[model samples]
Target chain A: MREKSGSRVSLRAMALLLCALIGASPVVAQELTTSLVDIHQGSPLSDRARGLGNGGYELQSGNRVSFNQWYRASWVDMHVDLLTQITEDAGILWGFGTGEQGEKYRIEPSLKLGFLTQMHPSPNSTLSLSLTTTIGGKLTEKSCQADYGDLGTYSVNCRLAASQMAPEETLKYLVNAKPESQHLWLNYRVTF
Target chain B: MPARHLKFGIATAFAMLSAPIASAQEAPDADEMAALCHGGLSICVSATIPAARTQAATTPGWMSPDVGAAWAAGYKGKGATITIVDDFSSTSRFSGNFGIGVQTQRHGEWTREEASMIAPLATIRSKDFTTSSSVTLAPGLNVLNLSYGMYATAGYSPNQIGWSAEEASIISYATRGSAIVSKAAGNDSVAVGGVTNGQQDYLDLALVGKASAIFVGALSTNGTTTNKAQLAWYSNYAGSNPLVQSHFLVVGVDGSKTDLYGTSFAAPIISGYAAIIGSKFTKATPTQITNDLLNTARTDTLVNYNASVYGKGEASLSRALAPVAIR
Candidate 1:
């Protein structure tokens, strides 16, 4: 029975590793171009941004890599992009007492899937329009930690261990960090 | 001479019978006295009167003083309504008047007073569960404070607990996440739903998995932002169940400060906290507000913190209100 249980665990681990390798593999591209962009550009590679909504400002930043594929057929042209973003430092500014007492920061990884299409009336024409749609949200299976601190030091989820203590006993700060809101983005670009 | 003696004896027998009848009329029997008392008589001679239940008067100081910061930030539970459901009167009378002379203080009165003192600007409504079990939800953000519990003579399963109209209504609201429900973990010093002296609080069992339900326990003393607090000697702890632990919270009861103590007083503080959170996160849903409080609870502020004992730990209004935007 013990040997059987060990074999089952080994099989599960191997299966998970295989899935990770497949997901990490780069997309097969006939032609590929990759470049880093500003975090605020709203592209898949732009993994960080700040915005004001619902009465407060929120800063969301993450590390991400994107894979893209372009296909051209006789009738139409298509582009597919897959991006994975990992939140390393996402913070929100909230006033508690004097100074920066209530600011909160967290980390959680997410994946974004996007599709783009472009049409050209004639090969010689310089005018073209491309439309893109992207869907993204936080991954459900991620580990998090709760930190009760004044300085907002750690970047992890607020699901703390049962008996963990804060760095400073005097200031026992609690943070209400929620999962990133799921979103769908559409963009249209016209080139001349 | 014999005829005169017979007439005297007959007169004596008549007098004795009439005298006994008159005495019976003057002093009613035990059954007759009980009947009179049931018929609304003011006084029933030789009847046992149950002792008058008493609670300590409300103290002037607020139990959780750190709420001052939230008040300073202009989140004094404005635009929210806190509905207190408890035994406001022994006669099952519903009175909107919170004035001193209108009615004598009962268990419900202390809870109402504490919640009002915590969030003075918030609207407070009383729901006398004795009169009717059904409760109507208020228009805007609503926080319902249940300082009383429904118990049975013998232990019953949650299904067999036989929820009344009010329990059903409150449970419906909690399950649907329509309002924030703060319940007092009973003062029996047992885990929630544990039987105490042959009686069990079935209401706690019924509310175990509801979405917005929170079971509040009492701490021994007033809690400060800098110091850790301990659970009161008589307050119930979160038992070994993870579901119960997830929804439980502890706050300072401080009978010394409030002149009132028990899990009953502990619940209103959480209700006030919910209303205050509503004032800040004006657009947040009831579930969102509930989560904000639970997720932000501080384990560091609790001495010997154990999930099974303290649940989510101490409810910190400052931490809950610290978030500027809550989805």
Candidate 2:
């Protein structure tokens, strides 16, 4: 009878703890740009990426913003004394962030800047110079870790092992690598 | 504090600590960014992008060489019948807009065009599932393409729900009858997960559809080359189910139109390959065709490959159509 009483008390305590947990889970739905956000979890590759055991999630919480847009903006260029418009430029650009391509699949920031500057020297002839550059965005050092289910690799190793089949099952490794991607281009043109 | 109270408190703390582990990645609305852009933009200006007009391949004027090689072998699905099942093809929902037979519907057209690249002479049939009679499956069809799946209602658990009986039986009956049912793995950007054990995961449509089907997932590409095929982030998948692994596959997403995406477009490519094999074998069963593709799938196609994420591997028409020796 004394043991039974103790068991009953334990059950009640567990339930109370679970209730408290359930009550606090609403914070997950909350989003903050500068705050930490859980992108995905239980990723075996993510675990290896961060040197965690097996299961861990990826995050995208920082001051990074996704911006992609194109507009036709026209502004007349006028020097201190010049009256007529000499050059005009109109172009489109897109800036975005995504996971890196290698084994350490971390977040990568990217931006594209472009402009077309045209000089109207005469009514029948004109010269144009087009400049474009792609800027790689900053990387976030923050990541999330969890208890990996070892349920499956989820192909995080497909590319890692694409060259050959793996021999070890217990060795903890990540399919995603902290992405180190760099892509930049600049174009200069003059057309008549 | 008493010993019992301390013990309970420690246990409570552990449980509380583990609670967040059960959390999953949150998915915003279809146009969540769009909504955000619209809001708080009353003072700022935004630009709009028009739909793509050229719809050209971003690759070097060629999508993949395997399909062409299969066609070169003279298979070309000459007499085989390839059936595509989707709502966009139904007459009731056609709406003279983007749908099957509506030349304007780029999504539907892309699937047809990709299939044609392999079996130009095959008899292509489009069955729109709008009513009872339309959903019927005719026997002797070499391959049936299903590029859709069920989505869970918001706030509901997918692990608890199962596929509808009507759909389940139809796929199963077809599979048993020797028709390779190529099904879509489904898109991400939604709450549903692919078929697998555990929370947030879903069963492969083959199991829920109660049919031995090839569940296809989407593979994103750089379009500049077919040398590497990466799994799409928004693709639904499964890795632990031994029963379904042999039949699940993923292919490059940028197959058809430049911007066309989703596993929906992934199914037709495999179906087309099956048709190419059928054009030659003329007597091969769906199981045989399925085996040919699975046995021939390659790991080298993936940059850093793992079976759990990629499944058997990408479809290989040349290997699938290769001659088998009498060993």
Tens-digit lDDT string for candidate 1 (A125-153): 43322222222221121223322222223
All candidates' lDDT scores? 0.52, 0.42
CAPRI-style docking class of model 1 based on DockQ: incorrect
Q: Taking the tens digit of each residue's C-alpha lDDT, what string does model 2 give over B1-327?
A: 122222222222211111000001111111122331222211111211111111212212224454444333334677667776554432221112111232334233445555665467777776543322324444454677765544333333433554444344445555584677776666652222442222222333334333347777767752112466677766665465655666777776652334445676677778777776666455556676676666666666675777777777776654454322100
With candidate 1 superimposed using the best TM-score fit, by how many Å does residue B78's alpha carbon deviate from the native?
1.2
Q: How good is model 1 by TM-score? A: 0.50
Output the lDDT of residue A157, model 2: 22
Model 2, runs deviating above 4 Å: A1-192, B1-62, B89-103, B106-109, B132-141, B153-166, B174-177, B189-203, B206-211, B222-226, B255-257, B324-327
Q: What C-alpha lDDT, on a 0 to 100 scale, does residue B216 get in candidate 1?
A: 91
Model 1, range B161-279, lDDT digits (tens) per residue?
Answer: 45667778888999999999998887778898888888667778888988999999888765543667888887888999888999998888765533455787788888988887677
lDDT of 1 at A111: 30
lDDT leader: 1
